[model samples]
Target: MDCNEYCELLPACADDELGAAESLRLEQHLAQCAACTAELGRLRALRAAVREGTTYHRASPALRARIAAALPAAAVPAAAVPAAAPASRPRWLEWFAWRPAANAGLAALTVASMAFGLTSFMLQDSPQDAMAREVVTSHVRALIADHAIDVVSTDRHTVKPWFNGRLEYAPPVHDMAAEGFPLVGGRLDYLNGQRVAVLVYRRNQHPIDVFVLRGAGSRKAAPDFDSTLTRQGYQITHWQAGGMDYWAVTDASAADLQRFSQAWRMASGGTP
Candidate 1:
């Protein structure tokens, strides 16, 4: 199968959810294609890291009790009333009986709880996923605007130093010319709620955007290759390595992107 086909099935392959025929086809392709092989390696490593890093915590008794208390009472206990009870109560008894102010307070608390849960889910990334999504979004935006970089240069030294005080950390920049991908330039962007440096590069006619940001938390033990196709036709691969989050996005074939990622891992002193 071609690279685009492979890219489409990669998430399934990584999750080992591919059907037999598809799995065989992908394996056969990997055997004959060095680039595909490299990509599979990166993806496998990323999946492992994500699995290892994911943590599940049970809610504390006190917290659970609070959540339960916030919910409207299901039914009033017999002990809460006299033997003789009113027969004209509304079908939706809880809503009808609740004080207006109490009902409003409960609605606000429910909304706040949902918002907190969503925010927590997004922040669960261990650098890799965060960086990858950032790069993907930036690339997609740049492609739509037809502007991918602020400063264009081939020299790593030139691009690296350009971010001097613009960012909190100096993003590691390298020229991969010998490997068929050349450094193009760099730009500044915001990702995961922080300002970041974006290093641009090219593989053949396609552009690859790499996002570099400060190590927000502890270093993840491996790369996280979260891939997704943008509405603008670019595929994004995001991960973390060497305590820095890196997200690379491009319209280049999946095999080419995988090759770039493998080369990047080697150049960065191995994944994680």
Candidate 2:
């Protein structure tokens, strides 16, 4: 199904109300569509937040005992009192009567939490914020999945050729081995609704992924196509070369990422 059709089923998918066949199709489409995948991620996160907010913790045994002790003596029958109760009749019966109301209060608190969390999350989701969130999530997923490199090689020739038919545009790959950001490998990734090349590199134990995609060339005739920013503690640098957009994301320092972007632009014969 197309994006619009898949989006229409997103709420159902989030609620697990879709049929098996339709769910399968949606999953297949999500594999290729980054936009839809990001949307699904948002939905799942929302559901998780709501679940977390609504979760209730039962009253502790100590608190229950204290409440029982504070009630009037005649309110509880002798059989209801525990061995530790005072000489007077314990009001365990009153405590039992109030238990349901306490539970109901907790339930109301959970609902309020869910509503507040949902509103807070929705308020922060501007287009730019969502894109940055997606970028950080993609970085985290790569680490968790342990599939950082699809074609592990230090050679640029080997890595660049791997994306020949997999993507519509050829991503320029460079071997920065001598420069300390060695080419570790490359992988095909979905970003911004298209399959792109993600060149992997490393500095010590830090891994950097450079996502490449087709972009409308620099908005001006001048070659001012380099920018850098940090999101979720990861440094990201964006530059355009040969009509393709490049974004390098890493835990490396800003200076290191900037150096890598400059080196990449030089290798691609683009302005720094």
Candidate 3:
């Protein structure tokens, strides 16, 4: 199977949801493809880390008793008392015993509390946030390298055509030379198991690298923005537009990158 096809099944494969035949096909491909194997390792590690960090807690007996005591007296059952009960024992004390209504109320409260806690945990531990952090790291690593783009050309015509059959989707390639950000060149880069087109451009002296990948969801006209400063002292802005994820990495200030991104959106007919 090709890398694209293998990626679609990786999530299912990790969950062991694939049928025997499909699982075998993926296994065969993984045996030959080192990149996919590495990706699988990353995904598994991420899942393990998130799972290990999640927390679970049970309500204490004292807390449960307190909650039960606050309910209506009719909702509680009578506690058992011997015929020779202590003369000092109060009759009201017998009604503090647990009842079916109390149990059901406690169970409902426990479920609601657990659901809220789990939702909060997942929002903080989302995989998408982790993946975005990794993308920023990759961009930083590429910036420090002697060569960022595999192919370097000044012409958009030359750069755009280079990715013809290399990827499943046509990446948005535009010339913003008139608006101060000019197209420099392009390259082939792999992100999240798919081969993506990396287009290089410049805004004044700052170098902005736009990494484009396929598989963005149905809302293709809007650009999604994410910003991070890399360890190498470069700033990265990422977004998705036209069914593609765009990561714009540069050493320039955020305002400049924002301007460049706006121009790019207009050029590509995508909403700002």
Let me know the TM-score candidate 3 reaches against the reference structure.
0.52
- By lDDT, the better pick of 2 and 3 is 2
Native-referenced Cα lDDT, model 3: 0.69
| lDDT tens per residue, model 3, 146-241 | 457776888888888888888778887898999888888887765665667888888788778787877552223123654443524666666666
Q: After superposition, how far is residue 235 of candidate 3 from its true place, in Å?
A: 3.9
Worst lDDT run of 10 residues, candidate 3, spans: 217-226
Looking at model 2, which ten-residue stretch has the lowest summed lDDT?
217-226
Badly placed stretches (over 4 Å) of model 2 are 1-9, 12-36, 44-128, 216-227
Mind giving the per-residue lDDT tens digits that candidate 2 earns over 1-272?
Answer: 57998999898999899999999999899767667777787798767767665434455666555555564333446687687875453456555455544645554566568776776665555544455556666776777757678999998889989998887778888888777899989887666656668889998889988877777522222233255567768877666667776677899898888888887777767666
Backbone clashes in model 1, listed as residue pairs: 132-238
| Top candidate (lDDT) | 2
lDDT of 1 at 272: 24
lDDT tens digits, residues 1-272, model 1?
59878877777898889999999888787655534554565576567756665444444556555655666655666688777874455787655456434655555567567765775575475544444544555566566556678888999989999999887788898778999999989888655556678888899899888877656632432357544434246676656776786667788887788888888888888852
- Of candidates 3 and 1, the better by lDDT: 1
Model 3 ranges with Cα > 4 A deviation: 1-128, 145-147, 215-223, 226-234, 238-240, 270-272
lDDT of 2: 0.72
Q: Estimate the lDDT of model 1.
A: 0.69
